[model samples]
Target: PRWRNIFKSNATFWWSFLSGIAQLLYVFGYLGAIRLTFMPTAYKTTHYRQPLLDHNGIDILRIESGYVACIFRMPSYDPSLPDVWQTDALISISIALTLFLPAVAIIVICSLLILRKLRIAKSTDISPQMRATQHQLLK
Candidate 1:
C-alpha cells in the first residue's frame, strides 16, 4: 500500500508536467498558424486612390483630395485592422479546431485514468498473504 501511494504520487506529478507541456505546445502551434497565415503585407498608396498634382508650382503629386482620397488611402492589408478582421477570426477558429481541443482532450483522459486507478485501489481488499509479502518486500 505504501509503495502504491508513492507510485501514485509520482504518476500524478509526471502527468501534470506532461499536461503543461501539451498546453504550451498548443499555444505555440496556434500562434505559429496565425503568424504564417496572416503575414503582414506592404502598404500600397495607389490602391486606395489616384495621386493628384498640388496647387503649388511644384510638380509633386499629392494624396490630399477630399473624402474619396480618405476612402482610398485607408490601410487594408494589416490583419489586426477592421479591414482584415475576418482573416484573424478564421485563423483563430482553424487553430482551435485543429490543435487546442485535442490537447485538452488528452489532459482530460489522463485525469480520468488517475481517478479510475484511485477508485480501484480504494475498493480492493488486500488478503493476509499479500499483505505479508508486501511487508517483507518493504523491509
Candidate 2:
C-alpha cells in the first residue's frame, strides 16, 4: 500500500521502474533472438588445426630443420571478426537509448518545470526585506 502510493505520487519513481522493466525486457528479447538465430555447435572454435601426418602415425617434420609445420584452417568469415565488436557496441547503444532516453527526458522536463515554478514564485514575492535589499543594491 505504501509502495503503491509512492509510485502513484512520484513521477521519478514511476519512470525508473518503467525504464528498468524496459531494459530487462530488451536484454531478454535480444538474448532469445541470438539463441534462436545462432544455434550452438559442438565445437565452437573459429579456426581448425590439422597436423601433418606421416607414414608412421606421427606428425611429419621438415627435413631441413626437423620442425613440424602446423596447418591452420580459418573460416572464410575470419577476416570479419572485428565486426563482432561493432555488433556488441550497437547492442549497447540500443539498450542505453531504450533504457535511459525516456528517463532522462522526463527528468529534464521535471527540472525545468520546477525551476520555472521557483522563478515565478520568486518574482511574485514582494517581501519588505527583499525590497529593502533591492533598494540598497540600486544605490
Best candidate, lDDT: 1
* Tens-digit per-residue lDDT, 1-139, candidate 1: 7988876667767677777788888989877765544333223233222222222232223424321111212335455875523444465557756897889987898787778777876557578888788889999
What is the Cα-based TM-score of model 2? 0.34
| Model 2: residues with Cα > 4 Å off, grouped in runs | 1-92
User: How much lDDT does candidate 1 score?
Assistant: 0.57
In candidate 1, stretches whose alpha carbon ends up further than 4 angstroms from where it belongs are 1-9, 43-96, 118-139
User: Per-prediction count of colliding residue pairs?
Assistant: 1, 0
As for candidate 2, its clashing pairs are none
Per-candidate Cα RMSD to the true structure, in Å, reads 13.4, 13.1
Q: What TM-score, computed on C-alpha atoms, does each candidate reach?
A: 0.41, 0.34
